[model samples]
Target: MDELSVKASSLGDNLSAPDGSDLPEPRRDFHDEQYLSQCSLKSRDLLLLTCPNLGLQVCWFLLMSSGTPYLESLDISKSITSLVWLTGPIFGAFAQPIFGILSDESRHPWGKRKPFILCGASCVATCFLALACAEDITDGPTNAPTADSDSTKHWYTQVFAIACVGVITFAMQAYQSGVRALIVDNCPPQQQAAASAWSMRWNVAGNLVLSTVGFLDAKRTFFRPEGNAKFKILAVVTTACIVVTVGLVSYYVADSSQNPRGKSRQPLTKLCWSMLCPAELSKHWNQLPPVSHRVCTIQLFAWVAWFPVLYYTSTFAYETVLPYNFARELHEKGQLDIRLIEHAELHRSSSMLYFAFATFATSLLLHMIEHAMPAFDHTQPRIWFFSQCSLGFCLLLTFFARTGATATIIISVMGASWAVAMWIPFALISAEISQPSPSKLGGKTGWILGLHNMAMSLPQIVSAILCAVILGALRWLNIGDGIAWIFRLASIAVFYSAYLINKL
Candidate 1:
């Protein structure tokens, strides 16, 4: 009898108490039924969770809006400078995927996302400083012409600045991935779209902040912002925002530490091997459902359509338009130098801020429509389709822009599309994977989202490569207003992207 009883207890999870009854196991908080059933977080918690993105968005806009012009300010050839632009998309290609894998599998006590967030924020601050100080440290000319560079002179300063930008892009991509995964982790699957919508709102808010700030003259204020001084001002302002927002979110928010339901971790070496190997990672890709594939495909083309616009809008304003505005007078006076370039870039930068405002305004309108009429939810695909097509039409209009102001107006209107693009794809992905409880993709949410990000980055890579080849040819032929034609050409891709969205 005793031997039989011992076998029974051993076979079962229950122990043989004095009464020979099983004791119930302790309930886990992470897997609490009540928590899983909740659709969304409270407004306060949601705000805290999304706060970091505000600063991050501002950092990204500052870079995309000004980086090209700033690089040109150093007198670097656009062909060679296009190579610097290439680093952003190159690192972007892998940075999110690798960071996503790491964040998903991380067993850190401080939290999976927190460590990455902290590390990325610190690196971003340093990288911005490095970019700001590039000319000073490498002894490169602080002010190069906006219109063109003298190819004969070579400066190591431009090289160092380029390196800083590359490092910063990787860090930025990782930081953004962490924040995104953290939001996904904290919310229930049902709230994925809402969560993504909130994220987009924060992004728009950041742009509004930039639009407000762009009007002020840094030199007129306390900073005396000119040349590298503007960059320093940018770096310092970003640092303050990061410290406040990232610090708050990282401390106040929680994240999944490897597994939410249980403590299990894949071997670290194996995870690293899977990340580095295309074949190994392909296994994870297969786990994603059809919706993930469709959404990611759409994102791929959508970004391809947008990269040139993002990178070259300011360039279009500065290169194609600014030349007509100021270049003729300055060239005639034999005083075509740094001041002319600075003023032109500053003017274009102010105009780019209007692009931000457009994006912000559009996002606000969308939120209102969605809130005021829940029935409009059915029209998302249609809304996305038309919005994207509008950008395509705007790109075609770029071919006819005779002045910087006209080009600025075209870029600003494109932001309405930008608003939709930012929200829908991510919200769709989140909604898809969440509907089936833990999801078929399961613990691989981070990996799946990483792949989605890869979709966006890869096209940018292709776009950058194309830009380099085309700009080299243009510069070689001594052609101005070439970017206008490039924009008209790119509109084809955007229209096709609109078709893809309609198919969705």
Candidate 2:
């Protein structure tokens, strides 16, 4: 038997023979409960879960995809755009952990997660609409051009937009953590990876379609000639879909009462403190099985490596590589006025299209690997180590990238590593951490997910601050010269993550 199997067997033995206790009545197997739940779920119910997640994924892609364009339309400098991108993760980082804890303790009739999902989607839609309105007003001929003019209006618009994003981000965190808990609550341990993989398929499909739509909308001006109208329309449409899908899904997949509500489960100050205390940390930490801990650590490192790349890669492409290549080519032909927007859009479309294709291919490959190696028991830490190493290697190749095609090739490889980084660790976590007994069905699943979100959020915060500083410093030192070093730093982080994952 492999290490995981041996450890699981040992756990089962320990649970079976509690120290100094009289023999108790045998309980139903956890796997049996999960099997029954899966059997009970109709095709329609499954569709409900899948559809909402797709909607959520689409919205996520839309926001990130449109962010740069929206900033450009506001007449913010490229330096400011980079800073705003970094700021997103700062707000998102704090929001996710707090929201996770809130969702865990929440007890509304709409269910713990559904309320947050609705709230989050609404907030995001509202914010996008507000931005659209701002864009329309700012770009109007009525507005006076001045040094302070752009800064003042941009600041207000950004404040509102950022606040809305923060709210939606918190909501998304609650929804994701809650949904994962729901899956663990309802699905058997053995099928967790399969279920997660299936869920991720929907996520990928949504990303492909959404990114395509955003790309087309940006390129063709589908919404209107008026600034940011497309963003508004897309936001409204996406939010409506999320609300309807989540509402229907929640209605069909009623919460199981297998885990009883305790009066002490109320979200109280004392209880919060008790949970946060270091002594309780050990108790809660001990509750996770060894495999679960390893998987979580692996996930932590994977996100640390991956999110920085995702957050900054597009910026790097547009600001650093694309400009330099296009400028050099144009300089040869004596063409000087290379509009940033035109160049940015061209590179954005190419890069996103490449990323979409890479993700689809990687997903298919992983699916096949899972099917072919059905009985393999590789741990997440090992997978994480190798993936991080791969990412680091690809990123380092950027130093040697001298042409657009070479840059695209490097970015595509980076995208593939990103694809595995996003999905694989979560799948491993689902497989490793789930309880095998119905009695401990809940099994601190919320806390585990909360910790996972925390890990993701912390690095996001760091990246935002660090990237801003690095980009700002680079701008001061002459912009063109500093871009490569930023990428090099990202590569270093990936290598460091590989090291950390190996230790885990």
Candidate 3:
């Protein structure tokens, strides 16, 4: 969120010249320049490089909406499903930082970020393929699906699916660190905000595409009977997209680094351990300036409010609005009804569409704010504060949302908050840390980006751990569906998060 007034001089100094020149340009275009001033890359060029996010978002939305339900489809117990729900946050918490440090330390010929990005994309694709074929691989005598009479011989498939999820989640986390670091490593300071905005916009666009696909697939019951074929197709489509986009980006987009070969560190293991170690991080934490502290704090509060909503909205809506005949179907047929699954899928996709649409609108709103308020780094604390409050109020309305439209509308409004939560904190933190010395920040971009990711992943882990207990307590209180109350509690967190913005 760099102020427009002071950007030209700072951006020029921060950006390197083209044609291997050491000199910085007198001024650079905030809108036109992609990463380097004299480099031919435009913002649209960077956008094309970032299209891999489209694939990532497609896979992510599929997992979030369908992963737990897939476990249930395998007839896995609630306990395992709940544990599986925690996988992304748990793996992400560790994987992102490790990937960050590795990318920061990498000296590959392709570039620091590209190698990790390619590797991560490959691993994710492999895992998705395995997941897509889970049923086929596990259809032997020990793991084959059974009839209604006997216990289903599908627990083995369930195990395989969960394993695939774990591996995929970790791989995606690795991919995320590299993808996010690409912007930091390449984009000049002035365009960082625009970079973040475009990334978010692309992210929402990806979400929108997947949501529409899911909705249509669900409506048609594209995968009949067990309804797992759609996921297989989704996995295949997303994997292909990942490989192509990541490969294209790797091949075409050169990283704008003056020093392509950074000094190699000591033992890789020790460096990774230090990066992952809380004790080691605390040392660096103590050295950071106040703005850095504020950014992290805001991230913590904001994500604590956000992660639960992201993880549980589908579950909550399924349980509350689309309550299917799970018990009756289970008792009579020893499996949940396909109708129930279809209903949930429809709701999940429809709700996601609204979420994406609102995110698009919110992005525009943020753009207006940035243009209108130039001095405060294109962001006002009060505006962010208001957005959070509005989100909390919208979450409050979730309690009364009876129909699908009601839920969609409420969550759509929550998008404004999500936009700010996702965009501003990263912009603020990156800007704050880059100010002391842009070159140093460039060297540690991956590390700092990793720390910022921790500010996101850590809260998700906390929320995942606490969600069951909170929902259980709500159920004990005998309120109208404890599952639905998760949204209400999240609203409370959002409100408190707004109060914390004053400190920023």
Candidate 4:
């Protein structure tokens, strides 16, 4: 919930003062006395603030699990649906920074980030609703005006589905930016690592929701379970979660911007300049505490592995299952049907469920390990190095997987590192910025976090490009199976990232 930000009492116009007189903790006692008294947060408070992430995560998983298939159901070609997945990376690269800047500068009396979050969440919810009712909305509950009605309705639904996905992609970027900013803005510096762990915990919960929903038979519902009924149920659950979690933090958390005056927009020229050549941000980049830079670099490489693996996991599961189930032979013999695909996808859902539990268990186990073996944690400084080594091994292992269960187990073991990847970087960055700085970092929380998000997204683009080039070269040369090379290359990248972790 509130884990995205630390304490307003701990934070302000400037996170620290020069001459080392002020660090993340201390403030002008006399001036901040009343504010700190009112705004100081407990562990429970941080939990409340971060709760919104749960709903946001559900929205994310829904898209990953259902977006393309939903479009396919509308009679859209598989090729077009595959391309639709690109919208997230493309929009994420641009949207996070823009929204971060806007949210940081917001002077809304209600709060700085909540207003943007509200707008974005509303739009996302609306899009989900539209997707859930695409057919009914495009045509009547029963429409058969002419012989051409089926084609006309399918066309309408196709366009409607695609449009909704586009809106959801952009809106989610804005919403996520705001929520992340809200978290960084509110939590105390001391709890960042815990916050990161909590973020992963919530992510696991979202995965559970996806797995549970996916496990349900489409025919399980009482009325019209064939078409969009499941999506409708998911939409209702997602909307309710947003209202409850977001509404809680919005109503309970104190306003972040102490400044009562309205935050005004910058001139277009200045805004563009800030985006293109932010001199101030560049200075901060250079001055970041040692660990922050190393973590950022490592994160970049880690995502090189993650980008392909995450995007391809469902396909990987399908393919892996097909070989074991004899579906591959059937396909080779030109026998394809809905049942065969469904059988394969059933295993995909099982893989996701297995991975979710692994991640959740790992997230919890890490904390216990830290407490039980303080000296071990000291060796890697937050077990980051350990995570990298395991992560690299897991990625490398993917290339040798020959069964659906084997692939699933590999993904599950990856939880050991995935837990760290989710929270450690954000926690590290937040801590670094909060420490005394060589440059102006005050009120730049959003931009700094935005840069981190950009780092993650940029890798997706690179990995996508590299995948294309590698695949193309393989086909051109008529080489042996090149798909395995993807994992090998990803493993190499991860090991290098692990090397960087040692530097950290």
Question: Which residue pairs overlap in candidate 2's backbone?
Answer: 30-436
TM-score of each: 0.83, 0.78, 0.83, 0.84
| lDDT of model 3 at position 58 | 70
Candidate 1 lDDT, 361-398, residue by residue in tens = 88889878888876664677788889888988998887
- Superposed model 2: Cα runs more than 4 Å off: 1-47, 75-94, 135-158, 217-224, 257-263, 271-287, 324-335, 339-344, 376-383, 436-442, 479-483, 500-504
lDDT of 4: 0.69
> Pairing residues by index, what is the TM-score of model 2?
0.78
lDDT, model 4, position 427: 71
Judge candidate 2 against the unseen true structure and give its global Cα lDDT, from 0 to 1. Answer: 0.59
Better of 1 and 2 by TM-score: 1
Ranked candidates, highest TM-score first: 4, 1, 3, 2
lDDT of 3 by residue, 1-504 (tens): 131212222223334455535454545554343343344335555576566776677778778766766667778787777788677877676778778877766666766677777788899999888887887887765454447313343666878988998888888877888887776655555556666766777677766766667777767766656567877777777787787778776765565322323355557888777766889887755555566566766777677768767767766556555543344447578776667666666776677767877887888877786777766574556767888889888878876877766777777787667777666776766665444243333346667777777777788877776777886666566554555666777777777778888756
Flag the better candidate by TM-score, 3 or 4.
4
For model 2, residues 42-106, the per-residue Cα lDDT tens digits are 23333455556676677667667776666676566667566555544554444454555565566
Question: Number of backbone collisions per candidate, in order?
Answer: 0, 1, 0, 17
Ranking by lDDT: 1, 4, 3, 2
- Candidate 2: worst 10 consecutive residues by lDDT? 1-10
Query: lDDT for every model?
Result: 0.71, 0.59, 0.68, 0.69
Error of 3 at 141 (Å): 8.0
Model 1 TM? 0.83
